[model samples]
Target: MADLEDEPQAATVAVGSLDDVAPPPRQPPSEPADPAAGSLERARELLAAHPIADGGSGLALALREAPLYDIEDGERLLETDIPRLRDGGVGAQFWSLHVRGELTGDRAVTATLDQLDLVRSLVADFAEGLRLAMSAGDMADARNCGRIAVLLGPVAGPALGDSLATLRAYHALGVRSVTISGTRWTQRTGLTPFGQEVIREMNRLGVLVDLSGCTLETMRSTLVAAKAPVVISHHPEPVPDDVLRQLRANRGVCMVACTGASIRETADRLDHVRETAGPQSVALTGAYDTGSPHAPGLADVSCFPRLIAELLDRDWPQPDIETLTWTNVSRMLRDAEFVSRAMQARRPASTARPTPLDA
Candidate 1:
């Protein structure tokens, strides 16, 4: 297998433009650590020095220099191909076990499962370099070992075969979370009614209910019905009519921002999300958010960096960066055993929601 740094390139990599989130002066096998740097500072340095970017994208993508990784041509996991990314920059990945089945059928589910199996294979294939992760603890351990932590989950649950049992099966397979309904409803969860059932069951099982692809009603339903904590895996979405379009959040559940880039509106949207989901419930996107070559760094995370820096440049509430970055998701993971008695203490005895979100 080709190592991350060994991939084919168009050129020897050049310094672009800070306006463009410029790339670094030269491409080296590994980078040296900045002697004096905070998290955000480190992010900017990565972009400013990155070989792929010419100028800085912006603050949004500037938080960290880790390269945004993508699944390769349906087979190989290319961690080494992107040396910068594999070097301990990326914290967590929602390795998309996405079933292409939105309106299609079982084929989509099968395809999604195949993607998951590929991930499992990649675990062994890249074991020395990477490992599968579900809880924050697993991610922490992986990071400690200098390995990439892959958080696995289905893009949507309906593709899991049929009922909640299939969902449970996937959970057993190490899927810490599951986006129940896709852009629209399907077999597993009805338009809205079944959505409620799915959320409730997911909550009880301690499985994270993902509301990234569901409709506003579905998002609302899951937020309102969840027994355990839930996450909006792909929200702050730029797509029209997305229920969690901007920064809408529900009380209790945490909202992690994810769209194309973490830009301006994202900050405003995230503020609103924090207001609704509670200061502890709202967070911005952490990885793969800067896939656009046009967006060079964190500031370009949607032009939201300045805003994020203005609002949360230092810190925000939640369980600290680790929790927002990996712990919260890890808490509900099926494979993690690091849950403190405190976490169990914080969990609600019932799934009843105290309030509905306005997103």
Candidate 2:
């Protein structure tokens, strides 16, 4: 995949005096709508009708960009936006704390912390509907309690600079996953000697390594180095067999992104990967969020059920579908927490940070 280049600017609309143009006669009927939308709607209906068969237990999850911070002007989460996710059958979401690559050193760290504060405030403001979930168990608990479990992830490793301790520190502060690079390469791109150290540290800390926007080389190197399962939080393109084989060998999952271009062919690619790599290797993510840099297509969080529906239409088995929607992601997260907890148990009390569960 190419480094995410500067997106071509949106086409500007020209404004002119309406009085200068004459009124048209009758308009022709609109063309037949694509079946995708209707199929997606049917999927939503299925989710609503069935309710995941476990009360949102093992229900859908979305790797959404940070909604609270990225909201358009005059938008509010509690009053207006979050309900859409609720309506979309989203049981959990990984809200990103994206620090741009340009913000190096303390600026990046400070910005990440500020976003953390923003996320915390969101949980507080929407207490009944949201909860801060730092582990897989916490996520399940939040779902069981009928609240959407909100988890923290930061896009790009620049927020950590050159500090391995900073990665651990973020884990202590409830960051469960992190993207190693963004549109640009991070300080440690996993292709360098120091980058390997970063990957190993992330594995040791049980922080899920995300290889979303990194270079192919970075993805390969990181896969080799990471002891824990990794995820491509937003895979905007298809991978060759070698990459799929490597991901399978490393027990990683790629959250197939749902942008305009990515969405159209996602199912076909997903099928090919499943056939080549196995069912455990793929999951779903909607990176073309309201704040997505990609051109608009999939509208919002609501597009998820539609995606599920699309797969269903193709006769994907329910079990395989669950693996695509939930099980793959759930397993990765649960394993990360298991490793973390085991490590914490072995560590001396002086070295271990106090976890919420222990409290």
Question: Judged by TM-score, which candidate is best?
Answer: 2
**For model 2, how does the per-residue alpha-carbon lDDT over 1-359 read when each residue is reduced to its tens digit?**
24445666676546888776667898899999878777777677655533221111101111123343422222333212456666667777777777555787789888788777767776787778878887778877887888877777744577875566777788888887777774233323335555665665676677898877677777888778777788877655676678788989877886665655544476776788888768898876655332444223445565567667768779888778777766677788887767666765664322222233211
Q: Per-candidate TM vs. native? A: 0.58, 0.72
Q: How close is each model in CA RMSD to the real structure?
A: 18.1, 19.1
Q: Which stretches of candidate 1 lie over 4 Å from their true place?
A: 1-82, 86-88, 101-103, 183-194, 236-268, 286-294, 298-323, 331-359
Give, for candidate 2, the lowest lDDT window spanning 10 residues: 53-62
Model 2 segments more than 4 A misplaced = 1-42, 45-80, 182-190, 261-263, 288-290, 293-297, 342-359
- Candidate 2's displacement at residue 109, Å, is 1.0
* Tens digit per residue, CA lDDT, model 1, 1-359: 56966977665444775565555798666877643335445434342222110111111122123324432221122222223334324544555555334434567666666666766776776576667875667766776776666667635665744456666667777776676664233232333444565565555555666666566655555555554555665543532323332323332334444333434444555556554444544444433423422222332222222333334444454234333334444444432232323344564433332122211
| Candidate 1 structure, TM-score to reference | 0.58
